[model samples]
Target: MNKIKQGIEKLWAGPWVPPEHGKMPYFWLLSLAYMGWKYAYVAPGALELAMLVLTLALFVPLYLASFRARGWQVHACMLAGCLFGAAWVRWNPGAATFFIFACAMAAGITKMKHAMLAIAAVIALALLASLQASGNMRFLFLMPILTAGLPVGVGAVMDARLRRSRQELLRKQEEVEHMATIAERERISRDLHDLLGHSLSLIALKAELARKLVHRDADACAREVGDIEASARQALAEVRAAVTGYREKGLASALASARASLAAAEVALEENVERIPLAPAAENVLALALREAVTNVVRHAGARRCSVSLELEHGVAVLRIADDGQARSAADIRHGNGLCGMRERVQSVGGKLALRARAGLELELRVPAAVSSGMNP
Candidate 1:
C-alpha cells in the first residue's frame, strides 16, 4: 500500500495537472465507479469482461496525460480516448458514462465548432448501434443527449470563458509594456537635450575662438582646435552613456575646456573652483551649463576678462560664470537653444539658472547640495 501511494504521489509531483488542479482525480474515480456499477449487470463472458477492464485501464492514463502532451501528440491521444470511450459505451449500452467523459474531454481541449461537430458525428453512430441492440428509440435519442451533449455544452462554455480571460490579460500586459517603452524614450530625449545642447555650443565656441586666434596666438589656436577634435570624439561616448542613463562628465572637465576656450579668445580668466560633492547627474548638468555659459562668453561676449567661481552657500552649490563680454540682442539672449536647455536641465534637479546679460554675460546656476541623492544619477 505504501509503494502504491508512493507511485501515485510520483505521478502528481511533476508539472502535469488536469485542466484544473485537485479536481480531476475525482473525475477519474467517479468514472471508474460508474463503469463498475454498469459492468456488473452487463456480465459478458470472462474473456469479454477482461477486455473491458483492460481497455478502461489502458485508456485512463492516456486520457489524463493528454493535457500535458503537445501538438499532434495530444490530439492523437484524444482521438484514441474518444474511440475507446465509444467502444466501451457500445459494449454495455447502459454504460453511457464513457460517452459523457469522452465528449467533455474533447470539448475542453478542442475548438467549440470542431469539438461539437466531431462529437455529434461520433455519438450519432454510437446511438444508432445502441438503438439497434436495444431497439428502444427514446432511450437511444434522449439518453445520448443527456449523457454526451449536456457535458459537451458545459465544457465548451467554460473553455470559451477561460480563453477570453487569457486573451484579455495578455492584451493588458502588452499595453503596459508599450507604455513603459514610450516613457523611457521620452526620458532619454530630455537627457539628450540636456547633454548635447551645452557640449555642441562649447565646441562651436572653441572652433570660432581658434579661428580668431590664428592671427594673434598661432600655437594657442592649434591647441584649441585640438580640443575641439577631442571633444567631438568624446561626444560619441556621451550619446551611448545617455542611452544607458549613466552619463557623468562633471564640472572639472567643463571648466578645463572653458579655460582653453577663454585663452584662445585672449580673455584673461580668473577661477575659484573647489572639491565639491554632488550627484553625478547634478554635477554633469551644472558642468554642461558652465560649458554653455563660457562658450557664450567666447562667442557672443567681447569681454577682455572672464571670472569663474563655484562655492557652497546657504546649503546649495552656486556656480557663477561672468565675463565682461559683448551684450546680446534681446531675441537671441532670451530664446537661445543653449540657454533654454540650460534652464531646463538646472530646473530638473531643483536648481535655478539666472542670466545677467544687460551688463555682461553673467550666468549663475544654483542647486541644493544634497539634490543628487534623490535622483538615479
Candidate 2:
C-alpha cells in the first residue's frame, strides 16, 4: 500500500515533485472539476470514468509543461490538449474547459488579434463537435463563448501589463546609464581643473621669468628653472592623487585630497588621524569612504567647518566625520544611492555606518578588525 501510494504521488506530482501545498496541483484539481461538472447531477458509469481518467492523463502533463515552454511548443501543447478535451466531449459535456485553457495559452503566446483568431478557429471546431454529440444545442454554442471569453480576456490584459512593465524597466535602466556617463564626464572635468589649474599657471610664470633672467643673472635663471621642475612635479602629484582612487593609496592620500577639496569649497577642515595597519582591500574601502563622506559634507552639509578623526579600539576601527552645517533637516535626508552605496561598501567589509544630525551632521563608520586583517566578511 505504501509503494502504491508513493507511485501515485510520483505520477500526480511528476517524478520531479514540486514543493508542498503547490498552487499547480490545486489548479489541476480545478480543471478536472470543471471538465466533469456535468456528472455532478448523475452518476457517471465505469466506462465514462475510465475515459475521464484517460483524458486527465493526456491533459495533466501537457498543461503543467506549458507553463515553462515557449514559442510553438507551448502552442503545440495547448492545441494537442484542446483536441483531446474536445474529443472527450463526445462522451461528456464538461470537456469544453480544454478549449478555454487553449484560448488563454494562445492569448499569452501572441497578440490579441492573433489569439482571438486562433481561439475562434478552435471554437468553430469545438462547436461542430458539440453539434454532433451535444443534447442541448443552445448550451453547446453558448457555453464555449462564456468560458473562452473570461480566460482569453484576462490573459490578453496580463500580457499587455507584462509588456508595459518590461518597457518601463528597460527605460529606467537606460536612464541610469545615461546619468552615469554624464557623472563620469563631470568627474573627469572637475579632477583636471583641480589638478592642472594651479600647477600649470605657476609653471608658465616660472618659464617666462627664466627667459627674462637669462641675459641678466645666470644664478637667477637657474633658480627659475628649478622652480619650473618643482611645479611640474607638483602637477604630477595631483594627477597621481586622481589615479590613487584605484591604487589603494590608503587614508593619508584620501585625507590630503579631502583637505584640498574642503579648502576649495571654503570649508575649514580639522583632522586627527592615527596610523592603523590594515589589509590593502580594507585600506581602499576606508579611503573611498573618507572621500565620499567629505564630498557629502561639501555638497549637502552646508557646513563652514568639518572635522575627521580615526581611532582603533577592541579590534575595531572607527572613523568619524562631522560638519558644523545642519542647514538641511535630518528628516529630509533620503539615503539615495550615495548613502546607500556608502552603506553597502561598509557592510561588504563587515562594517556599519551611523548617521546623526543633532550636533550638526555626523557620520560614524566602523569596521571589524577581522575584515581589516583581510578576513572574509
Candidate 3:
C-alpha cells in the first residue's frame, strides 16, 4: 500500500515539474479531443495515425519538462511546440492546441518585453500554419487563431502579477525582520538604563558621603561602605536577571527604591499608591516606567519634591509621576531617549503615556485591566 501511494505521488508530481508551479498536465491533453473529427470522418491510413501518436508521445515529456526550464531552455520548448503544430496542422487542425500551450509557457519568461515578443511570434506561426493548411484567410480557418491570442494576453498578465506579488511578499518579510532586530536592541538598551541608572546614582552619593566621613567618623564611614556594597550586589543580580529574562521589578519594590533614590538626592518623596490587582506584565511595565521617571527627576528635574501615585480607575491602572522641579520644553522632552523609552514601554502592553509640563513635569501611564494574569494581586 505504501509503495502504491508513493508511485502515485511520484507520477502526479514527476521530477521535471517545478514544485512551485501548478499541476494537472494530463488534464490539458483532453483539448486534443477535437482531433476525433479527422479520425472519424476522413478515415486516415495507419501510417498517418502512427505518426500522430508518435508526435503526441514526444510532446508530452517536452510539455512536462517546460515547467522547470529557464532562459533559453524555455525558448527551445516554445520552438519545439510551434514546429510540431506547424508540421501537422495540414493533416490535423486540432494541432493548434500545442500552440496554446507554447504561448502560455512563453509567459513564464523573466522579461515581459521578451515574453510578449515570443508569444506574438508563436501566435503568428500558428496563424500562418492554419492559413497555409486551408490555402486562405477565411473565417472558418481563423477560428483556431483566436485560441492562440487569448492565452498570450491572459497568461502574460497573470504571470506578471504573480511575480510582482512574490517580490512584494519577500520585501515585507525582510522589513519585518529588520524591525524585530531594532526592537530587540532598543529593549536591551532601555532595560539596562532603567535597571542601573538610579542604583549608580545612589552609589555615587554614598561614596561621596563615605569620603567626607572617613576622616571625622570611622563607624559612619564603614556603614556607608556596607550600603554601597549591598547596592552593588543588588545591581549585579538585577543585571543577571535581565540577561536571563527574569527581570520583573514589581511596583512595590520600585516605590521603595524611588524613596531611597529621592532621599539621596535631597528630594522630598510623597506617595498615594494602592494595592490594585495587576497582571505580571502590566505591573512590570508600570514598575519600569516609575523607576525611569524617578531617575529622570533626580538627574534632570532638580526638583525639591517628587510625587508617585497609582490607583485603579474604572478597571484601568493609572500611574502618575510628577515633580515640582523646573519644567522642560516639549521639544526637549521629545528629544530625550529616557522619555522616549518610557513611552515605548507603556505603549507596548496596550497602555498609554502622556506628559504635561507647567511649573514642573508630570508623566502619566494608563494600562487596561483586561490583561490581568490574576496572580500579581
Candidate 4:
C-alpha cells in the first residue's frame, strides 16, 4: 500500500514541460507520414525501404536540434520545420508551403506589426507555390494561414498576463514590510517609558525632602536619605524589567507610587480615582509620566500639595499629576532632562504628555483606553 501511494505521489510531482514541448510534434508527424506513404505507394520495393529508414533517422536529430536552441528561437525553428515537413509530404499540395511559412512567421515576428507582415508573406508563398504546381490554388492558399494564426495570438496574450501578476506580487510585499517597521518602533517606545519614569519620580521626591531638612532636623534628614536609597533600588528593578520586556507594571501600582512619593515629600497628595484597565504598554508610559510629574514638583516647584488624577474619558485613560508647587517658567522646564524623558515615554506609546502651570505645576498624560483594558486589573 505504501509503495502504491509513493508511486501515485511521484506521478503527480512529475516534471512539467510546457507549450514548447509541442514544438517537436511535427517531427513525429513526419515519421508517421513516411510510414503511411511507404505502405500506400511503395509496394515492398527497395526505394520504399530506403525512404522509411531515412524518415526515422530524420526524426532524432531534428528533435534534438530544437532542444539545443534558445526558447523563442526553438519555437520559431520548429514552426519552420513543420512547414518544410508538410511541403515534403505532398509537393503537389501548395497548402504545405503555406503551413511552413505560417510556422516561420510565428517564430520570427515577436511584434504585432511584424507578425501581420509574416502572415501575408505565408499567404503569398502558398499562392505562388499553387500557381507553379497545377493544384487547387484557392483552397491551398487560405486554410493553412488561418490555422497557424490562432496559436501565436494565444501565446502572446498568456505572456502579458504572467508579467502583470508578478508586478502586483512585488508591490504587496513592500507594503507588508513598511507596516512591520512602524509596529516595531511603537513596541520599543512603550518599553522605555515603563522602565525609567517611576524610579525618577521617586528620586526627585526624596531629593526635595532631603534638601528641605538639611538644616532643620538630623533625624528627618536621615529618613529622607533612607527614602532615596529605597527609590534607587526600585529604579534598578524597573530598568531590568524594561530591558527584559516584562509587562508586569499595572495602572494601580503606578498610581500608588505617585501618592507615596508626594506624601514622603510632605506634599498633600490627592487622587481623582477611577477603575481603568491598561495594556502593558499604556501602563508603562502613564506610570512613568506620573513619576516624572511628582519628581518635578519636589525638585523644582517649591509648593506643598500635589494631586494625581486617573479617569476614563472617551475610550482613553487620562492621568494628570499636578503639584501646588512654585511653578517653573516654560524655558526652565524645556531645558531639563527630567521633562524631556517624560515626553519621550509618552511619545513611545502613541500618547501625549504635557507640563503646564495654571495655579501650580500641572503635568497631564493621556493614553488610549483600549491599551489600558488589555492589562490585568
Stronger candidate by lDDT (1 vs 3): 3
Cα lDDT tens digits for candidate 2, 133-241: 7457347534865766456646643764576578799999999999988765654454444345445645665677789899999899998798778668856875676
State the lDDT of candidate 4 residue by residue for 16-108, as single tens digits.
223444444444345334334325543556764675466446644444444334546655655554555445434323235325434443433
Name the weakest run of 10 consecutive residues (lDDT summed) in model 1.
Answer: 368-377
| Model 2: CA > 4 A from native | 1-29, 137-144, 147-154, 157-175, 178-186, 189-377
Model 4: per-residue Cα lDDT at residue 152: 44
Check candidate 4 and list the clashing pairs. Answer: 76-107, 83-100, 277-372, 278-372, 278-375, 279-371, 279-372, 302-326, 303-325, 303-326
Assess each prediction's global lDDT (C-alpha) against the native: 0.67, 0.67, 0.78, 0.59
On the 0 to 100 scale, the lDDT of residue 306 in model 4 is 80
Q: After superposing candidate 1, which stretches have Cα over 4 Å from the reference?
A: 1-225, 326-332, 371-377
TM-score of each: 0.46, 0.44, 0.63, 0.48
lDDT of 4 at 228: 88
Greater-TM-score candidate between 2 and 4: 4
Worst 10 residues of 4 by lDDT: 89-98
Give the lowest summed-lDDT range of ten residues in model 3: 134-143
On lDDT, the candidate that comes out on top is 3
